[model samples]
Each structure stands twice: as C-alpha cells, then as structure tokens.
Target: MKPEIFIQENIITIGQLLKKIGLIQTGGGAKFYLEKNKVLINNKKPEGRNSKVKNGDLLTINSNIYIVKKEQDI
Candidate 1:
C-alpha cells in the first residue's frame, strides 16, 4: 500500500518526516531516535536530521513505507 504525504513546499526534512509519522514528539527526540534506529530514505540511510525529502521520495522506517506526494489543491 502506498501512503501519501501532502505538502505545500518542495521538500521536507528527515526530522519533520519523523514527526509527521508520529515516530517522535519533539525535534530533539527525532535526532535521538534517528541516531538509535535505522531509517531509510529511498532505500538509503539518511545522512542527517536535515536530509531533504521531496515528491516521489520513499521513506521506510522500521520496515513500514511512506510515499511523498504533491498536495492537491482541491
């Protein structure tokens, strides 16, 4: 199943993504979680908390998948 993520901007950071997924509550928590767990962005581990994710990007956290999509202005 493909999960959609709608955003108003061109991209979102890794830390923001974690929060959006409800994985972490705070920005500092995101940092700590990323350091402890393995998060794959488009099949590769993220370089840092600020890694940019854009449309069509694939994010896998703990084996679950999330797909980034453009927000439809309907």
Candidate 2:
C-alpha cells in the first residue's frame, strides 16, 4: 500500500505523530504500543516515544508506512 503522509509543523514526537494519525487513541498509548511492536524509522527500529521526527522521515509500523511532511503555509 502507498504510504500515508502526515503533514505537520517543524517537528513532532513519535508518540504525538502516532496519535495524530489515529494509530492510537492517546499519546500515552504510543509508549505502550511501541514497547510490543517494532517501528522502523528511516529503515531502522528507533526506540523511545520522544524520538524526534521531521519532514521526510519514513516510519513503518506493521505493514503500513507513514511519511512525515512539513505543511507549507499558503
């Protein structure tokens, strides 16, 4: 499947992004989920909900892919 794009500001935490994308009901849930699942960021499994994610970063969870993009002001 095609990767889903998440447009945000300068940056956001991994946990925050997960919640924003509806992967979790709350940011707190991200921590619990990450503990049992391996999420690949830029092709590497990064640990921590505080992991900084910026534009162009690729995240893969299970078989789904998410791409972070900076939202440009029109």
What's the TM-score of each model vs. the native? 0.84, 0.84
**Candidate 2's residue-wise lDDT over 1-74, tens digit each?**
55666665788888888788888998889888888887878888767888878898888888777777888888
Best by lDDT: 1
Output the worst ten-in-a-row residue range by lDDT, candidate 1. 1-10
Residue pairs with backbone atoms closer than 3 Å in model 2 (clashes): none
lDDT of 1 by residue, 2-74 (tens): 7777666678898987887688998778778888987888999888899888989987877678888868676
Q: What is the Cα-based lDDT of residue 26 in candidate 1?
A: 84
* Cα distance off (Å), candidate 2, residue 15: 0.3
